[model samples]
Target: MLLVTGITGHTGKYFLKELINNKYQGVIRCVVRETSDTSLLDNSGLNIEKVVGNLNDKSFVEQIMPGVEAIMHIYNIHHSPVIVETAIKNKVKRAILVHTTGIYSNFKYASQEYKNVEQKVFELTKQKECPTKVTILRPTMIYGDICDSNMSKFIKMVDKLRVIPVINKGESLLQPVNARDLGKAFFNVLLSPTETSGKVYDLSGEKPIKMIEVFRIISKEFNRQTTFVSVPLSLGELLAKSIKIITLGRINYVEKVQRMGEDRSYSHINARNDFGYNPMSLEEGIRIEVKEYLEAKDIR
Candidate 1:
């Protein structure tokens, strides 16, 4: 049996689709929160067991680990230590952890926690007696649909507003992997356990593109001419701080503006060679996102 978490989330949904499409002949168990909508799983027509509980609860995770031979942990990297410890105790064979490339961020405040959790995971799996073989797949910014938080926001903003604000003249490079591509990567890695276990793969996009070009792509998809206003780093930070204060800490973009100046690009050559991982180009991916956004909002 294969245990999957976050199966209802944006990427997880796609992963589940891949499993169904590929005819994975295994009993699948999914861990979900009490409030998570399981309509998709209910209609998926697969023999799946839905266990509702918090992954942070060790006892809850332990109870579900009895028959689960493999695990696809797709949510909350912070909860990985618990999952790893439990998987080890349960003697699970293989575990695929979905982590983020944000661990490489230059911003210490954001990257420190990821580093700490990853360090713990590394230490846990290094023990000689550890039974579970772990594979960590770190994806760059994930974007493909309206459910995503990254490009969807940009798509909505670009569609609604004619003038877009850009930090550092929007020259910083970003390589965002599509959610479906990441989902396929998970499925491929799961099948090729021999090559993926005890390995780390960076699932990046086909190539890097400038941040300004990202906005421009959405504009072109909508067939609209958009104006980009260059906002200096210092000024952007100041405005973000002011917004946070005025909103009583409800709105905060101070760190986002700061990080916008840093280039975030990673190579996935190793992933391609090992698991046949291939990601779509940004132009094509953004067009899909725009179509989804338009359909969701019923906009022409």
Candidate 2:
């Protein structure tokens, strides 16, 4: 069985689809929390085995680890320690861990929660030869047809604000990989665990573009005359820190925005050489996101 954690997330749903569509030739088990949204899995005609429990639960994870051939651990929650322990204890053959560039970008600025979870992964992986091989995929900003990404968020904000905000004259660079490409990267990791083991693959788009240029794409796509208001990174950081405390449980949108407004691009040569992973260009990904956004708004 292929156990996929974070099965209800943005990329998780598509990960399930690729596994099913490619006829992975095994049972696809999804580890989900109590409040996880699994509606997308309904009527997908998949050989799915749903395992409902906190992946952070040592006992619960142990129960699911045994007899599983491979594990696609795609969560950033508090599940790393338990997952690593259970995988080793059960001698699970492979563990394809889906991490993000957040591990790098947010290394200094990341919330304690993200840091703890990330540090735990490295610590556990350092223990005992690790019965399972670990493939870590650090994906860049991801956008897709169903995405409400930074671009889409701005488009939505345009509905409210006559101006769009940019940090440091919108000079920060971003390279967004499409959801399908990200899903394919996950699938590719599974097929070539040895090549990817103990390696961090930074999956990115073909090119990195500036933030202001990105906003231009949004404006052109939505046909909005949204003005650009640039601010310094220091001010943005101050706002992010303040907002981080104010909105406790939310996704920390400010910190997330600040992270995006920072440049962190890398070579995909490793992904391509290791598993033939080729992502869509930023232009194409943007077009797809725009097309989907328009369709959803019924505006075109």
Clashing pairs in 2: none
Model 2 TM-score relative to the real fold: 0.86
Model 1 TM-score, all chains together: 0.97
1-300 per-residue lDDT for model 1 (tens digits): 999999999999999899888877879999988889899888887888999999878899889998789999998898899998899998999999999999999863769999999999999999998999999999999998988999999998998999999998899999999999998999999999988899998999999999999999899999999999998988998998999999999998888888898999999999999999989889999999898888878764
Error of 2 at 272 (Å): 1.3
Name the runs in model 2 displaced over 4 angstroms. Answer: 33-40, 106-108, 111-119, 145-149, 237-261
Taking the candidates one at a time, how many backbone clashes does each contain? 0, 0
Overall lDDT per candidate, in order of appearance? 0.91, 0.75
Error of 2 at 277 (Å): 1.3
